[model samples]
Target: MAEEPRDYEALMALYQAEKRRREAAEQNALEEKRGREAAEQKLRPTNLPEFLDACHIHLHASLIVQKNPTMSTQGNPDNAKNKLRPERLERWEDFAKHQMAIWDDIMASDFASKRQFAPLSALEQSGKDLRQQKIGSEIDLHIFQRDTVDKRVSSIIESMYYNKELREKFNLLGTVNFENHANMLSPESQLEEGMEQLTVHQKGKQAKEKQPSGSTDTAGSSHPRADQFCHRTAAFIVEYKAPHKLQLTHINNGLDEIELEDIVQDVVQRKVDDKDDVRRLVAAVITQAFSYMVNLGVEHGCVCTGEAYIFLRVGEDPRTVYYYLSVPEGDVTDTTGWTAGLEGPNRLHLTAVGQMPARPSTPSCGQAEKRHQSSDEESGPDPDTPSRQQSLSQPLSRTQKTTRGSSSGRGHHGERYHQIDRPTFLALMRRQLADDLDTDCDPVGRPGAIGVLFRVRLRSHGYVVAAKGTPAWFIQRLRWEASIYERLRPIQGIYVPVHLGNIDLETRYHYEGICELVHMMFLSFGGNLIGQHLTAENKTLVSEQVKRSADAIHGLRVLHKDLMPRNILWNEETKHVMVIDFERAEVEPISAKRTWKTPTGNSVKQGQTGPSACTKEIRRAMTELNALTIVIRL
Candidate 1:
């Protein structure tokens, strides 16, 4: 009745097929368009090297046209009679080839090996001669002299390196010289035509005035004028009269001569300015210098003058301090010495401190024999002296301990030991062990024994063991640290030392060394501590570390109570992170039992005293140990 139901199913299928076909065709067209665009991009000559070459050629041609305006007009001699001679054309082609060769060499050289003034080397060799020859032919071309050549060359090089967009604006070199002068034929023309055309386009009419004449023999010594630009916080101008002869001046409100004199006389002389005051000044200067370098995007060792001088301008006063760097006088093949010099006055110098060995003086045999006889006479111990020495050397017997009371306060808590000598303690250890200690165990293998501590290697990767056998009570306190390390060893990124053993007789509780501690810390909590080493991209690392620390605590049942700077170690080589001193860590199960003492002497206990005392004490000890650990992330 209704046209035999119109074949509804077949018609629907046909419509679906048509829609699919159209979609497929459209997708294929998009794919083809993308491929074509990519290919075109490749052919468009976007390579930096090619672009720079083209820019150099264009600049070179423009410079030639401007310097020799007669050639541009003579080439079309029928209407305008100025033309380039056959010999001049050949010379220009030769110069262009030389420049291209030099440019290629510079581009091919490694960035690390390339000097700052590398691009100007070729210009220095031939630029002045070329300008002089051009000016000699045309007496009227005095305006485009030696400085003009330098300005043109410098402009092109700077644009190529610093201003890529400007260089890329003119893709192909053209000869339609845009002479914007009010009167094109005027004898006193304000605009100079030719290679100066590019300069005019970039900087307008003032370009001619700014162009540097390549004739300056000492262009390197031309320091930027004080009025040019400087940061308000920290800035300095270093002028060098000769190689290794320099004058440094810092421009800042703080560190003025008058203020420094006042500080030295009123504060330091009067003994009123404590270490804190000196530290504050040092810190301020360091911070300002760091900020200044970072803002300028300069490498640490690149900006220093040849003589390595740094001046600090005193804030709020018109005075400056000239800090003379005492670098070793020799051929400074290494850049580290230059870098250290830039770090300012606090750099350590062993020679300056009188720690370096003094020259040996020869003694006569007669003088030596006389000294030996005197020593022999003095070595004979008197009866009273021997009894006194014996008494001093005698160890406290059990009877003496009984008389002093069995509960002697020698090893009691809060007991402080004074007048302990490092050498004596080391000698005692040697006597107890009856073996020679490894020379490598010493810090830096130097003469000084003060602040000496043992470094022990661990079996696990990224773990070190440290120990000191000082006071018995202090050594006992270290046992708590051993317990903390044992608990935290299993946690990822936690660099707590494994409690290998505590030799009570030797009073040495072994700890993992700092090297391994740092390695593991980076692996576990690297994102947080990575900023300590990476200055440029620190914000990202800092944010990541904070985020990770929070997430780890929330998700992995971990707690890093000692989240200070020193507790975190970042491995520079592997970029791994290690979190040390887990004496304060508390897993989720025992988190409640973590007790922290308040400033008001009130004890904050975490759980039931009887049931959780053991776990609570352990956590509490860890928390206390964390507080004791020094934080030095930087």
Candidate 2:
């Protein structure tokens, strides 16, 4: 009886242990399922601002600011800010009201919000503790200082640019540290003597590739210099003054109260020597930002002190600048008051979202319109010209002329070259190339692509370039593509983009710790992808165009191995087709045998010589084009 009792107790204990294990496993599976569901829910489409709000990136940014509060420190030894002189400076009383009106207009319009960046946000938030902990530590443990400020600002800006949705919506690229890095294309004096383009294709010669030039500005430059330069041509630059150097009191003081002459003459006469003068310090920093904006020919700029953001915009007269100071800690709030949306003194300003008051319009196709009118005037109006008006009107919807002009020269031609001064064009090219590259439109390549294509517009003259950027390690592919472009030189503007040149951009684009872009090859913008616009009506036309483009490539004794729909482009206005991405192309020798498959599934080989051989060579190249053409047939 005693032995039986002991056996029963042992069995019961084993059963209880197994039941507990099963229960724990069930709970874990349920939690994981819920987690997956939450992630999926977050991935639903949203706008940039809304998505940012949900992800709490801006909140975390605020936390970073709170944790690393600004500390007082000694001013810079250079006293450089005092020397800044702008042609004119003014703080319009109606600036904030004007900005609010623009916001209202934007909100009332049929504005399309960009898609969500949930995955990206999750990745960005990973490895960092989200829970409100670990904020306070010993000074020896947590080293929050000036560097932390740079990292935070840089991180936020970089993260914004990385989001393809945000980039497309805002038409922004990445930022460049002009203080530390050189412009990719510098003046002759800025570069080493006899520094020529690297023979990148030559094996083992990669080691000799020219490193980028050090920091150098224009000669006789008299403008205030900023640390960070954003967007090519410095259209939108940002100046970061450490909070220790620039405080809230300085920013809070209205520039309207101080006389422009008092500030400018003081700086010029070297009378504003007191580093402790709060009003003088504020004036100096604003003047500094204004000078950079004027010299860069940009209208928009920002002066950040980590705790404060001062948004500046130059007026129609480049000399006159307007400033709006925003302190997020004091300005922004969770609650929305009854008069929140109203345009009044008590109206709320959501400055954290980086919304600016309306400005002048953007670039349009006026040149194209001019050409059409000239042809009409020269050749007389055709009956079909009226019919073609609607088609022409599509690309010319934006009527406002671009404010972007070069101080160095007349101006630049856009994607399509017009007869212009070659010397002027060359000068503009050297001036426009920056350390970082970003597209104003959608990127053709995915995040992890070896070669990403960006449609970059020149800031000076709005000349668009199809910039193909890749990491330095992938320089060989770029070299190969460049050679292929050279071989297709005869069809430069007709069937392909004009090869501008190549440069090694020292700035690195980071994403998921994968790779960084270090080199950029500039070419003219080929039109949109043909595959995207395939309609029942234009299918046959598209097919024929692709075939013609392929024939042109084949005539050069080159085989474009990849001739899919994605590789083909159609310019609707020009009625011209273009083929790109010659990375997989192969050049054949004169004696090499050329073969292609016919529509009847028969193998055909080209002759060794004569016009018949040329005809047969095209047939071989058309093998791939057959598949592209068949897309329309189906």
Each model's TM-score, in the order given? 0.23, 0.38
Regions more than 4 Å wrong, model 1 = 1-434, 438-440, 444-453, 457-470, 492-501, 505-532, 546-561, 571-575, 583-603, 606-634
Worst 10 residues of 2 by lDDT: 362-371
Lowest lDDT 10-residue stretch of candidate 1:
514-523
Clashes of 1: 45
Winning model by TM-score: 2
Q: Report, for every candidate in turn, its global Cα lDDT versus the true structure.
A: 0.28, 0.47
Cα lDDT of model 1 by residue, 351-465, tens digit: 1111000001100011001111111112211111101111122231212112112112232212221211223333443343333233222221100011113432222111222
How close is each model in CA RMSD to the real structure?
31.1, 17.1
Which candidate number would show the highest lDDT if scored against the true structure? 2
Query: Can you write out model 2's per-residue Cα lDDT over 1-634, one digit (the tens) per residue?
Result: 8799889989999999999999999999999999987776556654434433433333324333233533222335124333435555566667666666655544443332445333444434441433333222111112221222333333333444455654454454453222211222122212331232232112111111233354222222222344455322334556666554565665675444456667657667877554425666676677766665655556777776645777777778765667777765566544223131244332223434433223222111111111122111111111111111221222321111211122112355444434234355444554454433443422332221236555455555445445676666557767777778778877765676556566666455431112346676766545555544555567666667766877788788667654544456665545678777775566655554655432223444644443444455345434434443344445
